[model samples]
Target: RLQRDQELTGVDVVVLDECHERHLDADTTAAFLWDVRQALRPELRLVAASATTDAEGWSRLLGGAPVVEAPGVSYPV
Candidate 1:
């Protein structure tokens, strides 16, 4: 967890899935992880992934990291 110090050590990447929900805990975790990436683990790969997320906003939050858009598929019910 990002709450613990040095918790992310040895981690190659951290993928926060379903970030579009935007809950309090998720927001805090994102902020802390961003801080960790900035101040401690510069090489730590961080990914905020979601199906219906605000890519631009998250990109800004993650220090202007590039937002990669993947092709989506839709099926009719």
Candidate 2:
């Protein structure tokens, strides 16, 4: 995001690839997610993909927001 000097507020949708990736810097990820939530205009959507509980946890974090989980061709477990 810094490449364009853009803030998350300029975004309308957030797609979290490999939602199972837990090693992403927590602060940075949280900041991005916070902005995604705050920047939305109520009708905005967030898409998280991963066959794991990580996606579900994110939904709960966003207060039961809608989540789209895509089925992976191969199981990570």
> Of the candidates shown, which would achieve the greatest TM-score relative to the real structure?
1
lDDT by residue for model 2 (1-77), tens:
63343354566776666666667574476556666456644544566666665666888866797876555587579
lDDT of 1: 0.85
lDDT of 2 at 70: 54
Instruction: Give the distance in Å from residue 9's predicted Cα in candidate 2 to where it truly belongs.
Output: 6.7
Q: Which run of 10 residues does model 1 get worst, by summed lDDT?
A: 1-10
Candidate 1 segments exceeding 4 Å error: none
lDDT by residue for model 1 (1-77), tens: 55565658678899999999978988888888878888888998889998898999989878798999899799999
Q: In model 2, what is the error at residue 62, expressed in angstroms?
A: 2.0
Instruction: In candidate 1, list every pair of residues with a backbone clash.
Output: none
